[model samples]
Target: MATRDDGAGAWYHRGQVCCTNRKLDEALACYDKALELSPDNPLLWRRKGFALIKAGRYAEATVCFDRALAIDPDDATAWQRRGYALACMGRKEGAVACFDQALARDPEHILAWQSRGWLLGTLCRYDEAAACYETVLRIDPDRGSAAWHRERMRERRDLAALASEVREAERFMEVPACIREVVRERDYGNAELARAVLREMVGQAERPAVQHR
Candidate 1:
């Protein structure tokens, strides 16, 4: 494997480091540099879009995700992010459509399932929301929050708030442990899940990749 430590790969990996450190502006710059070297790389666009999402630039993020999908239409991550961007923009229907498309491409996508479930619940579509939660439970029974989602559905919370929460949780999962803890103080999280997420993030960051996690 060609590690990002070598050649043009350096830029991408550095960008990932910046992202992990929550330096989104710097991360975007690094990604842009890498894109200059590898214009066709969908992962670069996806990662850049992720940074844009964190920065609350939903429109720009959606454009980046669109570029990613253009290069690889079946990329479920891009589709999921497109959905997230739409949700951030308060476009509920479009967000749901994008989430549905993501799930279609990757039925096992846990985040997509959760997102769709939460959205459906907010819209008073209890049956569909329950179905989504059921899918999530079937896929990962160990998900402790699965049960709470049903309760959440009953509460009929704001979809926008739910969207923000999901996005924050996801971003938290991507951050380095040191920074994650700091961010966690202000965000809701489970200790075990955070540890698990940190492990995954660390593992991915340490892997040899010309792109990034």
Candidate 2:
């Protein structure tokens, strides 16, 4: 760690202060000065990236995150910020992948989970999105905003799951009449019945069609 006795540390501290004041440009300048003194410092690069992000220079922020990741591949926050930059650029697939990487590196990252939930919702993965919000609520129940998002997403997920079940039921009706009779007559569980039909259907599909005489 750089100490206050060093010029770079002094500049970095200045950068932090500027960032706290939302003076992003000044913060970037301070970080740039710090980087000039300590070129390989990943924290300086990451902080500069944050300033660039706040300034709406997402492309620059992305590059900064890349540099930070190169310096330390396990930097979860850098991965998360990279995802944020990609998302802001409308590159959702890349953003989601980055967020997944961030989570794989640090599952306890609440902002990463929250952001992933928002991205998953945008991608129409409502159930998965709801799961992410649910995790966020578990991590910080006192956050009313997170609680609200979780409740709404949970409702959507439940509705989606119900609709999925309805569709599966309709599909089940199209199966062999004999299979339906067995299912209706026997006290077999619905899950086992579905598995039985699936096995039969798969076996039939894998076998060659019988030739007509």
Model 1 Cα lDDT, one tens digit per residue, 69-179:
999999998999999888889898999999999999999999999888877776778768878888898999988787689655533433333334445556534554543
Highest lDDT against the true fold, candidate: 2
Candidate 1, clashing residue pairs?
none
Please give, for residues 16-94, the per-residue lDDT of candidate 2 as tens digits: 9999999888899999999999888888899999899899999999999999999999999999999999999999999
Q: After superposition, how far is residue 76 of candidate 1 from its true place, in Å?
A: 0.7
Give per-model TM-scores. Answer: 0.69, 0.70
Regions more than 4 Å wrong, model 1: 1-6, 155-213
Candidate 2: segments with Cα more than 4 A from true spot: 1-5, 155-213
> Model 2, 201: alpha-carbon shift in Å?
31
